[model samples]
Target: MLETTETATDPKRARILDGALKMFLAYGFSRTTMDDIARAAEVSRPALYLLFKNKTDIYRALASVVFEESIAKARAELAGDAPLGERLFQVIDTALISVMAKIAESPHGAEILDMKGSLAGDVVEGWRAAMVGQFTAAIGEEARATGVDLAARDLSPVMLADVLFDGLEGMKMRVSGAEEQRKAVRGLVKMVELAIRP
Candidate 1:
C-alpha cells in the first residue's frame, strides 16, 4: 500500500518532492536512491525518512503533485469565460502537452517515458480518468450554452471530449516544439468548431 498522507501543505514535503523530481529527471529512477534525494533536497537522511518511506513513495508524491497541478490549471481554463476554441486549446496545452513536455525535456526522458518500469502507470491512469471526466463536464456545459446538440449527430459530450483528448495526445507525440504543438492544437480546435457548428 502507498502512503497517502497530505504533503501538499507541508513545505518540507514539497521541497523533498521538488528535489526528488530533479534527481529522478537527472539520474533516472533506478539510479536515484533515498540518499541521493536527501543530498539533493539538503535534508538529512533521518528527516527524509520521517517524510517518505522510500524512493517509490517520493516518486508517488511527485506524480501526485504533477497531476494535481495540471488538472487544476486545466479546470481553471475550462471555467474561464473565454471563447470555446481558446478555452479548449488551453485545456489541451495544460492537461496533455505540458505534462508530457516536462518529461520529454528531462535528461532521462526515455526512462521517464517508461514511467519507472510501470511503477507510475496506475497513477497516470487515475489522472487520465479524472481529466476525461472534467473535460466531458466542461464540454457538456459549453454545448448547452451554445445550443449545440451533439446527440443529434450521434455524439455525446463525453465521446467528443475523449476524441479531442486522444487527438491531442497523438498530435503531441508527432510534433516536437512548443510552437508546432500549438499550431497542431489550433488546427484541431478549428476542426472541432466545424464539426459542431449549427
Candidate 2:
C-alpha cells in the first residue's frame, strides 16, 4: 500500500522505520522479514501492516528518513558562520560520506544497491540530487561572500559542486576506514580552498 500523508508524521510509523533500519542493517534486507520488523518495533503484525504494507515499504521509509536527516544536518552546517572550507568539509561529511559509509558497513549494502522493483534506489538518487543542490547553493554563497566570480574563473557554482561531489563518490569507493575518509575530506577541502581563493 502507498504511504498515507499521516504516515510521515505518525510516531508509530517513525518507530517502525527505526526498528526496520536496525533490523535491515543487522540482517541483510533479504533476510529481514515483516515479522522481524514487527517484533523489533514491539508492534503486532496487523499494526505494523497498518503503517507499512511490506518489507519494501519499510525499507523505503527507512531510506527516506536517513536521506532527510542527513540533508537537514548538512544544511545546518552549510548555513553556519564557519569558513568556507570548513563548511564544505562538514557538508561533504554529513551529506555524502556518512551515508556511503553506512551502506558500506551494512551487510545488506549490495542487496540495497541491486534491489529490483523497489523504491530504495530511487530514494538514494533523490538524496544525491538534494546533496548536489545543497552543495551548489553553499558554493554560491561562499563565492558571493568571497567576491570571487566563479564564472570569471571558467567555472560555475553548480560545476564546482558537482566536481566536489563526484570526487567524494570516487573517494568513498577507495577509502578503507574513517581515517582515510577524513584524509579524503581534507584533500577535498584543500581543493575547494585553492579553487575559490583569490
Give the CA lDDT, 0 to 100, for residue 134 in model 1. 82
Model 1 residue runs over 4 Å out of place are: 1-8
Q: Tens-digit lDDT track for model 2 on 1-198? A: 113344466868867877787787788888899999999888999999887889988777777776777888788998899898898888777766676677767777767645623558778788888988988898888889889988899998888888888887788668776668978888987887788887
TM-score of each: 0.88, 0.87
- Considering every candidate listed, which one attains the maximal lDDT? 1
Error of 1 at 71 (Å): 0.8
**lDDT of each candidate versus the true structure:** 0.79, 0.78
lDDT per residue for candidate 1 within 4-107, as digits (tens), equals 24554577787788788888889998899999999888899999999899987887777777777777888888889998778888888876677678787888
The best candidate in terms of TM-score = 1
- TM-score of candidate 2 on Cα atoms, chains taken together: 0.87
